[model samples]
Target: MKKPTLRLRLLRSFLVILTPLVLFLYYENYYAIKIVREEVSQSTSNVLSIHITQIDRTLDEITHYLLQQIVTSDTKSAYLDMASLPETNGNYTLAKIKIHNELTSGSTAFENFHSFFAYSVKKEDFIFSRSSFTDTNDLKEMLGEYVREKVKGQSFSDWIVLRYWEKSYLVRVAQASDGVYIGAVLLLEDLIRPLRGLDYGDRWEAILLDTTGQPLTKSVMSPETMTAVNRKLVTNPLAFQVFENPADHKDYLLVSTDFKQAPLRLAAMIPEKSLLQRLPFFQGVIYLIPLGVIVIFIFYSHYLRKMLFSPMNSLIMGMRRVVKGDMEIGLKEAETEELNFLITTFNHMVSQISHLKINVYEEMLKAQQSEFKHLQAQINPHFYLNSLNIINSLSTLGENDLIKKMTEHLADYFRFITRSHRDTITIDEEVRHIRNYLEIQMLRFPEKITYNIDLPEPFSRTMILPLMIQPFVENAVIHGMEEGSKPFHIEISAGNCQEDPNCLEILIRDNGVGFTPEVLSTFNQKKFGDGTGTHMGIWNVYRRMRMAFGYQAEVTFLLGEPNGAIVRLTIPAIGAFHEMEEEEDGKADDR
Candidate 1:
């Protein structure tokens, strides 16, 4: 069996010995920290809870006072056509003033108070203000419509905002009897001040968020933390939740409680750092106990080094040699039984690897030789056919245009065969070469074929494997259309495929004798059937496609209806074709 790795052996030894010792230390530290954090959290939660509850009670009292004042105030009837009152009306108003004074003074939990305008179906307008000469009508009109909406049936809503003097207030509406509405604002900062005063010197902070989860106010370390807390509350709105910063992985705890009498959300945030601060100083001593473990590790490491590390070094060196192609080398022998067995297995592995290399090399050589022979056979036949046409053209050409076109075709064909430096050419250059070949053939069989090339203007700069379309054209001429007075019309159009924007599609269509069902099947199979003659051009083009682009870029031959054949080739055009086309264009321009 193979020997265990050095890391595994070290880990096993550590787990058997050091793990329990370290684990005990970890548990002690973890639990101790956890206990302190929980205690601080629970204590702060309780104190903050009590203070917030009192604030809620105070807000309820404010609502009750508003309700009582609107009900008792008889200014509406006294201003009417018939005005009368009991004789003790002055004392009654004085007593009402006393009660208002007591409620305002008792509301030390709030920064300021203002009663919103009361609108009633029975009473036309009822407004009050503490300022003697203040115009309460404009503010009352603003509250009037909202009061009407609230009394009509919609629940009154609350909003909180931090105002002057670093105080935050919750402003909301409440309904009294008989279609009357009162809007009051309560300050939570004063309420939370008592909770802050109960801090036990642990760097803790207390904050309050109204039920809407907007940050009413905070005493955290930074404003960024406050923003993060607000964002978290809005994202995940569970009442009591703890979240960690997704970017930094720091934990933050949030606890929210509902006020029984008001539509208020009281949320408190305590950061993980604040919780960790509550641990006692004595726990630091317990964490430092692991320092004594150094002596035991040193004695143990010395004995394991000779037995484990030395054998591991030999194994590592042997692996490096194998990776670097010296597969015959094997590990050195060691006295340890595990190391002995490892070396023996390594020798067997080396032998198997050496045999594998020979087999792979032999198979590759066979493939390469076959490819070479196939290339040789394919190139010669194409050359012979083109050379025969050129010779025939030279022998019988009369006009200057005919000779010039023939020479261009002959030159282009030879240039393509001789150009060994590049396997690809620009789409414009490929089209030009095809034009030259067609121009030459047009002279010999002037009435045999007519062809048109259609490609997007921008795509003329894209690249394609050279001679990709040439062979297909040659096949259409030779196999599909032999001769006619009305020449076979061939149209070649290139564009981006509709489905895949990254791919380019080339369609070569010819009005000629289409393929039989058998021929179509043979083309699809891409093989010779029953020893019948095969077009070397089509086969060679297919082989080149497989070699260059694997299976993604392929050529398909389809027999069109009546008397036509369509050859479509789709190739990746975004990066591969565009870059190569530009490079080829640069080279051509330089030439």
Candidate 2:
């Protein structure tokens, strides 16, 4: 496993020591709050139960009177009896008036009732009723089918909360024989209105729900409280739940109870803040313990930042500066022991890096010098004697002009070979040396050799490996020429390579016999030579380029269009690397 940094280790240690105290205080506070919420919730739920019971008793009383008057009397309701008789009967109108008066008189005793009605199953209409708000025709339109379904000899139904004519009511009905229904309906709001007077705390609300968990009354509920009550009612409808309101952003205790005589649920919502307001005075002192821990934790964090992290930041910045090649930066001495050790180690590392950079640069310069001297050694002494023989043959032919030309070519060739060794020289000097050697070949083979040199003006002074192109040209002349009726042609061309604006391309092509398939395969695989000294010049050139500019040296051998060999070389531009080196050296000088 990787070891942790000093900052990470220190932070973890601090948290390990601090966490248990925080959790203990938090648990104590949580335990006390839980105890207080339970007590307040129990008290509030009992009070809500009593309120539900009061509503049930009031409904039960109204239903009891209706049941007795309609079903248990010695006579069925007079209006119900008259509904079964003919409309032409003499007592029909009188019975209607008489029974309506009785219903109105009975309804006055229960002032909470919105209405009372007796339905006539035979007539399919209400024959006795007490409601001034809605006329008999409107009542028949609303409750006509409801009355018929309820009075089919069933005794009664539990009070069901219903919405009628845009108003919610608590409706209870009792069947009086097969032809009559005596039912009482009181507005549901009137039944729950007493809840507003009861106190849990300010902004408390109550909602009336049916057994299916649908709210029948939203009057006392704020939209936020009603939403919370409904969501809690889904999971557990008969007990208490706590929920947070999104709109008001406060916790509320929801108290609910099932009704025995009514098909409804009574739920009340009181603020959790109010419930906690009833906590004992000692709880505040308990709260201060956790609060004090938070204050200490914050103070410790600030102290750690100043003592440890601030110094660590300075070390990190110094490391970044070195990575970007600024080797002159050093961190200040830190106050802590661990940080001081790290800073001293860091400063030592940077010093070692500076020394290593100088060593590598010196080694590269020595390598370049050794490769140039190696190229000078590659010149064959036999070739010098061959040039002398060529000059002797010219003299034997009694051609003074050709002899003078051959002597000058031989002079130039040997002069270039014996000159002082340089790591780099101009493209102009290298090209001049190549031209002089090719001219000596033309002098020797006047009719058989012809050459073209296209050296553009722009790259003449571009610094490149000394004698870089000469070896390849020498190889072409020695290995590529064949005895032919057609004149052998050698073409040397130079231009910019696309990889960099300063990168140069040199193409040396010859109309001579190309390599056999086996030799081409060896070149293609980059196995430049066998164990013997075959293709030594090509091998030497390729290795020297790699040593200097790395992979930017590209040498490719291809078969020409009909029968010649083509050597194409792409080498890196050296100007940019040297310019960067110069800048680095100048920075070192200033430091």
TM-score of every prediction relative to native: 0.38, 0.56
Q: lDDT, candidate 2, residue 357?
A: 88
State the lDDT of candidate 1 residue by residue for 469-537, as single tens digits. Answer: 888887787777845476777888999899999888999999888788888887878774322246667
lDDT of 2 by residue, 328-406 (tens): 9878998889999999999999999999988998998888777656654664353566567777887887878888877
In order, candidate lDDTs are 0.65, 0.75
Deviation in angstroms for 54 in model 1? 81
Model 1 worst lDDT run, 10 consecutive residues: 76-85
Candidate 1: lDDT over CA atoms? 0.65
Clashing pairs in 1: 211-265
Count clashes in each candidate, considering only residues at least 3 apart in sequence or on different chains. Answer: 1, 0
Task: List clashing residue pairs in candidate 2.
Answer: none
Off by over 4 Å in 2: 1-31, 41-273, 280-310, 380-408, 416-428, 457-464, 498-500, 529-532, 546-551, 572-591
